[model samples]
Target: MYWHIEDSRYRIANPIQYLISKLGLSMDSLSQFVLGAAVSTAFLGRKIGPRKAALVGGVLGTLPDLDVLIPFADPIDSFVYHRGWTHSVFVHALAAPILGEGLVRLFRGLRDHRWLTWMTVFLCLSTHAVIDAMTIYGTRIFWPFYPDPVGAGSVFIIDPLYTLPLLGVVIWALFRRNWTSRLQTSVVAVLLGSSAYLGASLAVQRHVEQMALEIFSDNGGKPERVLAIAAPFNILVWKVIGLDRDSYRNLYLSLAGGNEPLEVYTHPRNPELIACLEDTPAYQKLDWFSRGFNRAELVDGRVVVSDLRMGLTPGYAFRFVVAEADGQDIRSVTPKRDLSLRRADAEDFAWLGDRLLGIPAARAAEAGFQSTTRDRAAFDCSTD
Candidate 1:
């Protein structure tokens, strides 16, 4: 759901958030359910009237994502709190009856089919969790019972390839006066195609992981973990990360870049930056949540830690000025929002496209980019 911030919700009082709002493109938690509701209503409304079913699906689908509205102390707290308790399965069981009965009372037509209404509400709530679980970001779908998040790492949060087909069907369904035989057939085709696309994406992930692990071995290290995330919009290109005991290694792989050197990039965790604050509760929570794919740097007289999984190396999206430091002796360590990431400009995106095509310009993109980062080739950082 991190990508859901495309005009995403966790803006934290930034200008990009405002710009995205004006742009009318959002991938937030609410927008995702809105997309889900449209598709589900189109399918379920076949037997029931489309208007009523849409009312139910559109409203109910968004209930689970109410977590986004709750503001926490800082952006990191907000990130941790989101997709937590509210997205759990128990919320569905407890909420469906209250929501279903309320809908029945308002609609009057659903009184005779209260069970159907209840089932529809349950479908909306449960599917929200299921869809979130498919992404690499954490979703505590089984919360209260168990506190850990379940991430399948299959898809990015807002793949247009996944949502566009469903959105197309929803638009078509809205126009039909009644669900006909042909309409039902069209609905079924969209559903099947979307599911198959998800399956294929996962398969590609598996292949990418396998190759990335081999690359790690060939580079004189054994991989403890491998994460192959698809690049921004397309699945043809992937950013692969491998973690060893010492550091996390990154590489860009595309379908077109077969059997060539992978141009692996290494980022040391720089545990030295957090040595004094490692025992703090804030550090512990972030460590667990990030699965150790995090790096700390000395920036502007402060020690900052960022989750590398959420964005590419050097300029990650989720950074926190975790501590105040004076020559490596931390005076204080507190979780504070550090919105150092800027929106990807046209040239940044153009570089991404060039990387996808394996062009020479792509190699130059990171040449001096790592000067501000922890890349081994860069100068050694001095906390002083």
Candidate 2:
């Protein structure tokens, strides 16, 4: 029997199903809802009343994610197809006017402020895509015109620092029966604050990238690409990944701490194991989705590929069993999500606090900080 272990906690499902099954809300969705409600309330509140505008805005904000309910052929299709056409700015541009016109006709008060209504709808919709593109998970903002995903990788997916202020202002506005000048100023202030936070994150990311490049070069390592992302909920600590020909380097830096020697860990890419499967649809999709930051391994006679951008070292959020050993040859199989290597240890969260404070701990591998290596000898791909 071909049996593989799966983690039911991290299983993929349609967004609605996943929300219901987990009884939890994703930060991305919450951020979008807050942003939409805030933007609509700020611009359309005076004309259409704050409560109604916020309600409509909240619904529009979640509209783009509706693409998740669309069925795909396979797991790989489902993975890469998300945030594609629906998140596109071009699509949002076309959709805004239609939605805006409908709202104008539906609400008699909004008929006089057609242009403001359209602009508000457009900004509410496009901001969702803009914020999504800020994370490590790429978004195809341009879509059909430019199919590649764009990821700023500056901010973590769920940052309470960025979302809470905007949410507070929205709640305040909702309580008031009428939109006052004071409420309008508060809304504008929070919106600007959120934008400034994003800008600051981008600036910090550039600094980290330059630092990583210099450190890699000083160590006699020529990295092909370097990516820096905020660590979890805070921007004070950064996780940097440097991609090379045969292996990748992972390091963490705390801006709060002054200049300190970085401890870099190297992990094998095992490209040879998947050289034969490169042309397969599953491999290609993963490669494109991860922007070539993917690694392959052979485990239990199965060929697995993992996106290196998400999760921590050794474990990843998206791993797929794309191929299986068939005697001396490898055969492509339907992509099956493999969460056996996914790690979510509570100890790692403890380590994150110390690491963020600039306190050096034991070697990452020994300190239970999501640092480990996979034994390549466990499975052989000599035939490939």
lDDT tens digits, residue span 1-384, model 2: 001233456556334433432432366688899999999998998987888888888888878888887888877787888888989999999998999999999999899999998998898889989988998887899989999988888988778999999889888877877878998898889999999999999999999899889898876476999999888887888878899756788778888783355677777787665675777878999999999898887789788998888778766767888988765567778888876653445567767878777776433443333323444344334323
Q: Candidate 2 — which residues are off by over 4 angstroms?
A: 1-25, 258-261, 326-328, 362-384
Give me the overall lDDT of model 2. Answer: 0.79
lDDT score, residue 242, model 1? 85
Model 2 residue 262 CA deviation (Å) reads 2.2
Relative to the true structure, how large is the alpha-carbon lDDT of every model? 0.68, 0.79
Error in Å for residue 119 of model 1: 1.9
lDDT of 1 by residue, 1-384 (tens): 552232233455566645653443255454455555555564466656554565567667667677777767755677676788888989788888998798778876677878887777777788778777777677899988988787766676667787777666666666665657766676668767877877888899899889888888888576788888877766777878787644677777776564364577777766666565566666666777787777777778777888777667666757777777665356545577665655455666776777668653443445533322333333323322
TM-score, one value per model: 0.85, 0.89
The collision pairs in model 2 are none
Off by over 4 Å in 1: 3-25, 29-31, 256-259, 355-365, 368-384
lDDT at 238 for candidate 2? 85
- Model 1: residue 13 alpha-carbon error in angstroms: 11
